[model samples]
Target: MAGGFRRSGQQRQPKLQGKGTLEKMEREGPFKEWLGMPDLYRHTLVIDGDTYTYQVEDAELPFAPGDKVVFRYKEVKSGKWIDRNSLGTWIDPSTYNQ
Candidate 1:
């Protein structure tokens, strides 16, 4: 699926409120490892000068090289794995002012 905005199903309540492309920050520091369902297709993302490939259920994410994503994760102690869902607003590096 091409990167773009995605509308949630009418049945479920929307978690995020906004229109157009939204951006968020990852102030929690770098992630140890990215996680997603195996069946989901993987997408490439660049954050903090690092290239990371991630798989997400929603395809409408505005992800591109050199973009920052606020990564949210769930720690699983029993399985010995870090599961996380990418969050935050998508920011275009080109447009970001230093």
Candidate 2:
């Protein structure tokens, strides 16, 4: 048979659970084994002072390494910390934080 799709029950879908909620952090998180956390929850970013996490799909197009980014931390109703929408801009790293 040519390339075919797996049955509905044969697929393993990932749950998009961010890391802003954790026992070691906020509360005891899901009992996820390894690789359970989505890519969005992988980064533990601490800028200025507060903690922050990235969004999954949005992260695919985000700040790159060595790029000086200007962003603001926004608190969601769920108590999660995230970057303010439309607030991130790329600045010259040479003059950043100076």
Candidate 3:
């Protein structure tokens, strides 16, 4: 229910790796909270002017806006809906550049 319809306890694998500037993180909506469900948020990153959204499970990802980061993600498709799900640890910017 975060990015796409993941069956209860279903697992996902990263399809690719991406590096970019983390621009923002925003809660998807209050609808879930209103329904007494868990809160979920999506993170936005910009790479070469292209913006991507990654569904993040962590309430407190270490990276901040304007910080460079590298992450693994997988695209999930359910019907016509597509979403990017963040996987694994977010590589430290200093370590990533070197």
| Clash pairs (backbone) in predicted model 1 | 23-89, 23-90, 24-88, 24-89
Ranking of models by TM-score: 3, 1, 2
Candidate 1: how large is its RMSD? 12.7
lDDT tens string, model 3, 1-98? Answer: 66654687665453567666666655453224346656666545454355566554545556667776665655545211114343334566678868
Q: How far is candidate 3 from the true structure (C-alpha RMSD, Å)?
A: 8.1
Q: Residues 1-98, candidate 1, lDDT per residue (tens digit)?
A: 12333464235322332112222312222333346523444444444543344444544555543444455433235321112364555556787996
* Candidate 2 Cα lDDT to native: 0.41
- What TM-score does candidate 2 get on C-alpha atoms? 0.31
Best by the TM-score measure? 3
Q: Lowest summed-lDDT stretch of 10 residues in model 2?
A: 19-28
The RMSD (Cα, Å) of candidate 2 is 12.8
Which whole-number lDDT from 0 to 100 does residue 73 have in model 1?
34
**Is 1 or 2 the stronger prediction by TM-score?**
1
Q: Give each model a TM-score.
A: 0.32, 0.31, 0.44
Candidate 3: regions farther than 4 A off: 1-14, 24-27, 31-37, 57-60, 75-98
